[model samples]
Target: MSKYVLIGSKGCGSVVIELAMLKAGAEFELEEIPYLEPGPDRDRLLELNPLGQVPTLIMPDGDVMTESAAIILHLADAFPDAKLAPATSDRQRPAFLRWLIYLVSEIYPTSTFSDDPARWQLPKDAQDGYKRTVDQYRKTLWGHVEDVADTPCFLGNDFSAIDLYIAVMRNWRPGRKEFSQSFPKLTEIADNIANDPMFSGVLKRNFDT
Candidate 1:
């Protein structure tokens, strides 16, 4: 109860929060749930979060916090010295909020729906087309970000959690290779995060694949 407890899976959305907490020097323990397949751990996840999602955080006061954006924002607020996000009054704050919400609300759902077409009640025959279409749509979203992205970071010189978000998210669905080819600027940001001493180890461990 002295520190937060994060429930998540490897290479999943939780990696962003894990990196954020690490960057913040927060004391927390990670509980890995085997979300890729069904088992006891997943059952535990269901009990904690009805949606059975990863990155469900249990606060020190026994409160439950879900959603990656909220958790990362909380960490940023809790440990401003970590510089994981821009301050509320900072000029970059609007851009930070814009993209963070965009990642979770827009691009993230494509992966969620595509992960299991059955969940959305799409016909089995239509599933492939659904996944393909969403996958392409996701790239379009990334391209929008790419158009505005800057070197070594998303918002120009200052690095924020958005960079970490990009670094991790680009590795999903269409994957790193396609990501590099289509969005070179964002790829540079990802590469910067991957090479950063503070964030690199967690990225490698979570995304060893």
Candidate 2:
């Protein structure tokens, strides 16, 4: 089988794609890009994605795909039997798309900024305060999702890619303990995903727990 080539770094956004591909039982190879440092891996990654982002996927057909959400969605569509997402005709499709995009647009960027305050051009002394503010706002966003979330899963009984997202993201910012306390419902969803046989190994490997 022709393998999909996944370009990503450890403990980064690529964890989500890695879990999604594993769930789909897709044949793939992971190419670790040296994060932020210049070398052959960085050069190759830059050639594929100028943004220098992780989760850049090279499909079996040799086409390059970027963005975590898009790659996971494509994987779901390609491996229908895996049921990584709701079918387009399914009623839950709207909610699936809604929250997936919400996470990408709203919550993900805060991590981007907080992880590297220099990206926003903040001074060294102000960087800590900036990250705190971003982390607090992220908690608020989590609260909103938690309020609307269903037990055992983000969209209810069925497991979808959104749960994969929650599983990885909840581990970031203000720490998992704070996340669990601030948003119990979402924590349940993340916990469930973490425990699932399909995802457990990858989660452990990524988080190094």
Best by TM-score: 2
lDDT of 2 by residue, 17-42 (tens): 98888888999998876658988888
RMSD of each: 1.4, 1.3
Clash-forming residue pairs, model 2: none
The candidate maximizing lDDT is 1
Off by over 4 Å in 1: none
- Cα lDDT of model 1 by residue, 60-179, tens digit: 999999999999889988999988888888999998899989989999988887988888898899999988899999999998999888887899999899998899998898988898
Positional deviation of residue 98's Cα in model 2 after best superposition, in angstroms: 0.6
